[model samples]
Target: MSNIIKTIDVTDSLENLKDVCDIENGRIAGKIFYDQAIYEQELEKIFARCWLFVAHESQIPNTGDYVTTTMGEDEVIVIRQKDGGIKVFLNACPHRGNKVCFAESGTTRGFICNYHGWSFNVQGNLVGQHESGIYEASDFDKAKWGLKEVAQVDSWKGLVFATFDPQAPTLQEYLGPMTWYLDALFDNQEGGTEFVGGCIRSTYDCNWKIAAENFVGDILHAGWTHDSAARAMLGGSVAKVSDFEESYSVNWNGHGYEFALDTVGNVAVLGESALNKYLHTIKPSVAERLGEFRSNMIGAVSSCTIFPNFSFLAGQNTVRVWQPRGPNKIELFTWVVVNKSAPQEIKEKWRKGAMMTFSPTGVFEMDDGENWEYCTKTAKGRVTAAQDLYIGLGMNSRASDTSLPGNVFKGQLNEANARAYYQQWFDHLNAKSWKELPNRNFGKQEAE
Candidate 1:
């Protein structure tokens, strides 16, 4: 056995790293959030290789419409093509590395670098440069000077994603069975979902993963964190739903969700008159299209995270991207999403409700930012960074059932989903290549 062990090559860099994350033991070192080296590695290995949500198709519905966003720390432009497809490119000029597009979002035939006269067409093809004679002495190929396009771009149910890795799996394959839960909000009607309000942006002094994990399955915090907001809106304390039937799910790639079996919208802070009436009227139609199980979830106020950074709240119809600024900061971009076919009043209600609950000035949003900021600030200490943070809640309590597609546990107030998230995080950090990623097994047994 000693000889056999000696023959095994152990040159992998991740193996040498200590205190990264121990998913099997359900412990995550605080340094992962405060360490500069780990943050840089995450940009290369995780963000660059993962399918990141860039924008909703509705945000750029017409040809030439575009939005500026980020993939990890790299600024990117997501644009609609004349061919009804979408394209994403690094938002930088190939000439002098200056930014090519400065506007947040707008419709344009092409982008012209403000720093220089170089121009790029809607397809990211280089069209012109100041005085063609400047490069006459050499072969300055315009075709090669086009914007640096992202390796892959795709959309699922109006949500667009892009990856810097050409070998990354298709968006549908990347999303996996999580689509079933996403459809609870996305596919509630025939027209699919559309972004209603303009995007809201805020900077938080917290690690990006802090927000991602919170959305994945942290319903436990809702009661305490948003207690004041809950009291003001509901005329009582945060409603106790401990007795309600709930479930949590985690996919192989770290996507996760937690939802309860509630008939009413749990997170809707808007007045109960118009929004509740509209949901009640549409409940049967939602049931018909998505089946009864998902229909029951339509207004249950679930939270979900699509692996690395995208997350949404179902009842509030708020979708956000937790854009990583660094190990200690995140830029959050939020938008209100509603069924495209919903009544105008219903859409407006969702828009206002999301603003009141999750926007930059939102009651709940302020509280969450405070907690995450303090957690991150305190982690900067040597003693705090050295401690092991426990995330073992409900570990090994998962059971298979027919109700959901991924690993489903019986209750919402558990950290099984968080553990699964860190498991995949460790996997991504350690993997030398995408091919080295574990297979799409949804259970702990299979993962082992």
Candidate 2:
């Protein structure tokens, strides 16, 4: 926590925002899915304060390379500077607030805004203007008219992140124990991971949290929601996720995942024999590099969500940032991840495998968006939004092993992660500052 008071000023009270989630009693209010005021509060408290994924280091390896993304509704440009450092800037030009960069990603020497011909270099410095003589004698200061920069920018194993709040914790401190689990996906090999190609973007008519929470720990839905996808890909075999032994949902801070140590079970679901074999062949190497405990997660049945709306499939290797378009909609950006050291063929297989299973039109991905959309659409009803949704499954259950790094619960069907996530959500919304936020998720003590 910072010594400075980093607080969100959502002064107006919302009638439906109160008691949206009661972690103590395992009650989840449907209004969390779609409430205008709650959504605005989230933008102020969560997105503006927390570290959000912006772009991968692999995406922009050279100077002047850039990518455009969003922090809540504020569009930002992530560019590689001439000094080899990365910088994130608000995409709007200071001249008239028009977007300086229109392309999602490409190499650029500088941003020349068509609105006023205001030119900014890759370092986010205003270097030129349409006419130099007109403003020469005026009181205009070119130095103060550069693009607005984000407060912090950093990366963990090639995954770049940025935050808007200057008083927020550093990227490493924010990640905490979540990095321990993330190693399986990011640092499984010596070279670490990189995005395979450009991302696949799609629009979803759903609250971002609905899709995020699904990946966080809702493994129970895999059997029913994606049954057709399983039948289509796995030759009519569905991996039983309900009571799987050696599987757990680990919650740390607001990040969480549900996983089964059934090695290659997820890879097999890709319906690709080559990819399955490749993952199987690398098990010993991964185990030696990481550990037997962590390596077992490779090609396993798992899904994870990092705090607010960043999600990915572990074995499937598709990363997603569920960008909030509004309370009732999201713009999902999808990318495939592969170990940088892997062979070209292996990397290609991983890319295709992820696309086959988790891309926008992929079987599993197709099954999820509609359900989330309907769940969000239903919350618009006055009676429906007021009612509490049941999240009492595995209620009062404690992890048999408190030695785990986080709040780990045995079984994939538990809603413990969902409860913990909402706890964090409410904590962010209710706290006066980041210093006041409670952090009891990671500890030796069992979660009550």
**Predictions: Cα RMSD each:** 5.9, 2.9
- The lDDT for every candidate, in the order shown, is 0.81, 0.83
In the predicted model 2, the residue pairs found to clash are none
Model 2, span 308-331: residue lDDT tens: 878888878889999999999999
Candidate 2, 76: how far from true, in Å?
Answer: 0.6
lDDT of 1: 0.81
> On residues 179-228, what C-alpha lDDT tens digit does candidate 1 reach at each position?
88889889898989899879999999999999999998888898778777
> What TM-score would candidate 1 get against the native?
0.94
**Regions of model 1 farther than 4 Å from truth:** 1-18, 439-448
Candidate 2 overall lDDT versus native: 0.83
